[model samples]
Structures are given as C-alpha cells and as structure tokens.
Target: MEAYWRRTAMWYGGVGLLAARVVRNLALPPAYTRLVVREMELMGVRSLGVAMIAAVFTGMVFALQSAANMARFGAEAYVGPVTALAILRELGPVLTAILVGGKVASGITAELGSMKVTEQIDALRALGVNYVKRLIVPRLLAALLVFPLITALADLIGLLGGAAIMFFERRADPWTYWNVTTYWVLPRDFLMGIAKSVVFGVLVTLIGCYNGLETEGGTEGLGRATTATVVHVTMAVIVSDFFLTKLLLALFW
Candidate 1:
C-alpha cells in the first residue's frame, strides 16, 4: 500500500509538472505553426471518419430506443428532442473524446516513447530546442483546438443520423424532428458539451506525453507506455467527465 501510494503520488506530481510546463512554454518563439497544423490534421481531419461513424450509430440507437419508450407514453413526437439533448449534452462530447482520445493518445505516446528510447529527445535537448514546446505543446494545442470541432461534428452528424432513421424507417417528419430538436436544445447545452471536450483534450494529450517521457526499458517500455497511455487517458476522460458534467451543469445551466 505504501509503495503504491508513493508511486501514485510521484505520477501525479510528474503529470502536474508536465502540464504546467506545457502552459508556460505554450507561446514560445517561432510558433511551431506548421507542426501544430500538422497535428490538427492528424488529430482532427484524420479522425473524422471514425467520429462520424460513432456519432451516426449512437444517434440511430438512441433514436430507436427513445422513440420506442416515447411511443408507449404517447410522446413519440418528443423523441427528436430527447435524442438531440442527450447527444448535445453528453453523448457527442464524451464519446468523441474517448474514441479520439484513445487514438491520438496512443499515437503521441508511441511517437514520443520511441523518440525517448532512441535518445532523440535528448538530442533535441542538447540542441537547445525545448521538447515541451516542440513536441508536447503542438499536440496539446492541436487536441484542444480540434476536439471541440470534432464534438460539434459529432453532434451534427448524430442529429442527421437520428433524422435518417426516424424519417425513413419510422416515417416521421424530418422538419418536425429538427424543429423540436432546435427548440429543446439550448446554446448552453452545446457549450457545455464543447467545454467538456476541451478539458478532455488537455487530459488526453498531457497523459500521453507524460507517459512517453517517463518511459524506460527501450522497445519493451515503449510498448508499455503506449498501452498505459490509452488506459490512463480513457479512465481520466471518463472519471473527469462526471465531474465536468456536474460542474458545467451548475455553471452553464
């Protein structure tokens, strides 16, 4: 128990320090604009297909189930609003964060871990280049900038999916569905979801980078770090999600 707690404390301290450095060095000279843009393409544009697929399926399932329940209550017309609210408020952000978080986190960890084990990071340090600025900051900033957009895309695609299922399969009115959705889901709900994704992005990037920097044991350690990055980011995203939702609800609502 003592060893475990001690290790946990060390990890917390390390991650906290890494996060602080990232913020402090965020505006370093030269801007690393190209690197950041590259990361955004990798993190956001490359991730579009997966995010859309998840969103569509999510919206479809929720619409089907919500419609079934609402039908029993003679409230089937409200299914659109229910599905919209759920996706905008919770499903879209959380799901996008988790899924894309896993992919991006693992990639960052693997890339950095390989660099670390190969002494490439040390070489950059010897050259006076800030690894945090060059590597961590770009990825972190990219995640922060793109995650909200991804979540918004998820929300939009999800709505369309729900409309498709409802209009075609259930023969429901698409205009009414969209109208009810727009009427029920407020700006605050959308903002709340985007806010959650922002924090989640910070968590994902930092955790991945931290694990990569801490990696040891060469290739074996790289493997472990990548695996740990995925697990840690996923768990962090999920646990923080509850607190974020609670806090955002109080603040936004």
Candidate 2:
C-alpha cells in the first residue's frame, strides 16, 4: 500500500511538471505552427462527426427514457427541460470529452510511444531541438482549442435531438419544448459545461503526452502507454466532473 501511494504521487507530480512546461512553452511563438494546425485538424475536425453522432444518440435516449417516466405522472411536457439540463450541464461536455479522449489520446500515445521506442525523440534532442515544445505544445494547444468547439457543437446537437424526440415521439409542441428548454438552461450552464471541457482537454493531452514520453519496452510498452492513456483520460474526466459540477453549482446556481 505504501509503494502504491508513492507511485501514484510521483505520477501526478510528473504530470504536473509536464503541464507546467507545456504552459510555459505555449507562451512562446510556436516553433511548430504547422504541427499544431495538423493536430487541430486531426483532433478537432476529424473527430467532429463521431462526437456529433454520439451526442445526438445520447440526447435521444435521455429524452425517450425521461418521457416514458414523466408520462406516468402526466408530466411529459417537463421532459424538454429535463433533457436540456442534462445535455447542457452534464452529458454534452462529459460525453464529448470521453469520446475525444478515446480517439485522440490513444492515437497520441501510440504515435509518441513509437517515436520514443525508435529513439527518434533522442535524435530530436541531439539536434538541439526542444522536443516538448515541438511535439507536446502543439498537441496541448490543439486539444485546448478543439475540445470547447466540439463540446459546444455537441451541446447544440444534443438539444436538437432531444427537441426532435419531444416533437415526434411525445407530440409536444415545438415552441413549447423550445421555451421550456431555454427557460431552464441558462447561459451559466452552457459556460460551465464549456469550462469543464477546456480542463478536460488539457488533462487529456497532457496525460497522453506524458505516457508517450515515458514509454519503455519497445512495441509492447508503446501498446501499454496507448491503453493507459485511454483509461487515464476517461477516469480523469469523470472524477474531475464531480468536483467541477459541485463548484459550478456553488458559483453559478
């Protein structure tokens, strides 16, 4: 038990150091603008379709389930507000972050782990290049910029999906559903979700890069790092969500 706690503390400390380095590097004129742009394309633009699909389905399912229960009490009309609140305040950002973590973080770990095992990272250092700045900064910046955009998109699409269900399945009037949704969902709710998404984005990229940079044991280690990145990012997002939700409620509600 002592060893386990020690290792955990060390892991977090290392990640924190990496995060500090990333922040410092970000302030400098990017030495790898092209890489940052490419990463944004891969992590943001390429991932949008998948995030949208997941969000729409999540909203549809929430509406369907909530409507079924609310109808028992003839309160089906309230489903709009319930669904909207769930999507905007919780599901939109959390689900999008998890989805991106699986897709982007895993890929980052695998790519960087391979480079480490191949000693390409060492080669960059030997050439007097700051590998962290060239590699980690781009991914960090891309994730920071991309996740909020994706979360916003997911929030909008999720609401639309819920609204559609309210219209077609529940036979609620469109305007009434819209009004109820808007009435319950404040700008603060939207901002809170987006803020959580930004934190998640930074953590995901940092974890991935940390695992990748520390990879060992050649191909097998690369595989392990990739797997670890996915697991860690998912857990981090969920665990952080609880605290962030609590804080947001205290501050905004």
Candidate 3:
C-alpha cells in the first residue's frame, strides 16, 4: 500500500511538472511552425475518419434506443431534442476523446518510447537542445488546437446521424427533427462539450509524453509504456469527464 501510494504520487508529480514546463515554454518560434503543422496533420487529419464513424454509429444507436423509449411514453416527437442534447453535451466529447486517446496517445507513447530507448532523446540533450520545446510542445499544441475542432465535427456528424434515424426509423419530418434539436440545444451546451474536449486533449498528450519519458527496461519497457499510456489516458478522460460535467452543470445551470 505504501509503495503504491508512493508510486502514484511520483507519477502525478512528474505529470504536473511536465505540464508546468509545457505551459512556461509555450512561446513558439518561427521554426516550430512546421513541426506544429506536422503534428496537426498527424493528430487531427489522420484521426478524422475513425472519429466520424464512431460518432455516426453512436448517434444512430442513441436515437434508435431513445426513440423506442419515447414512443412508449407517447413523447416520440421529443426524441430529436433528447438525442441532440445527449450527444452534444456528453457523448461527442467523451467518445472523441476516447478515440483520440487510443489512437494518438498510443502513437505518441510508442514514438517517444522508441526514441528514448534508442538514446535519441539523450542525443538531443547532449547537443544542448530542449527536447520538450522541440518535440512535446508541438504535439501538445496540436492536440489543444485540434481536439475542439474534432469534437465540434463529431457533434455535427452525430446530429446528422440522429436526424437520419428520426426521418427513416421514426418516420419524422427532417425539418421538424432539426428544428426541435436546434431549439432544445443551447449554445452553452455546445461550448461546454468543446471545453471538455480541450481538457481531454491536454490529459491525453501529457500522460502519453510522461509515460514515454519515464519508460525503462529497453524494448519490453517501450511496449509496456505504450499500452499503459492508452489505459491511463482512457481512464483519466473518463474520470475527468464526470467531474467536468458536474462543474459545467453547476456553472451553466
């Protein structure tokens, strides 16, 4: 128990320190523009297809299930609003974060772990270069900038998926479905969801980088750290979502 708590404390402390350094050194140089653009392509453009597919399926499922339940209660017409509310407020952000955590976070860990084990990171340090500024900053900034966009895209695609279900499955008019959905969903809800995505982006990148930096034991350790990065980021996003949701509700409601 003592060792467990000690390890946990060390992990958190390391992550906190990394976050502080990233924030302090956030000023971008002209040269870093290329790096940031590369990261944006890798993290944002590459992940779009998967995120969209997940959003569509999720919204379809939610609409189908909710429509059934609402029909039983003679409130089928309200299904559009309920589906939009749920997707925009919670599912879009959380699901997109989870997908990004699994894909991008794992890749970050693996790439960094490989570099660490190969002594490339130390080589940079030997050359008097700040690896954190050169490597971590670009990825972090990419995540921060791209995640909210992804979340918004997911929310929009998810709404379209729900609208499809309402029209085809529920036999509701397309215009009516969208009207109700837009009427019921407030701007604050959309903003709050985007806010959650931003926080999630920070968590995913930070956790991935920390695990990669701390990896040991050579090749075996690299694999372990990569796996651990995915697990830790997924858990962190989920746990944080609960608290963020409550806080947003208190602030907005």
TM-score for each candidate, following the candidate numbering: 0.97, 0.96, 0.97
What TM-score, to 2 decimals, does candidate 2 have? 0.96
lDDT per residue, candidate 1, 39-95, as tens digits? 999999999999999999999999988888889999999998888889998899989
- Kindly state the number of residue pairs that clash in model 3: 0
Q: List the residue pairs that clash in candidate 1.
A: none
In candidate 2, stretches whose alpha carbon ends up further than 4 angstroms from where it belongs are: none
Better of 2 and 3 by TM-score: 3
Quick one: best lDDT, which candidate?
A: 3
Candidate 1 at residue 79, lDDT? Answer: 90
**lDDT tens string, model 3, 1-253?**
9999999999999999999999877874535988989999999999999999999999999999999998998999899889988998899999999997679988998899889999999999999888999989999999999999999999999988988888988799888777877788889989999999999999999999999888899999999999898889989999999999999999889
lDDT score, residue 252, model 3? 82
Score candidate 2 by lDDT: 0.90
Candidate 1 segments whose C-alpha is farther than 4 A from its true place: none
Give each model's whole-structure lDDT. 0.91, 0.90, 0.91
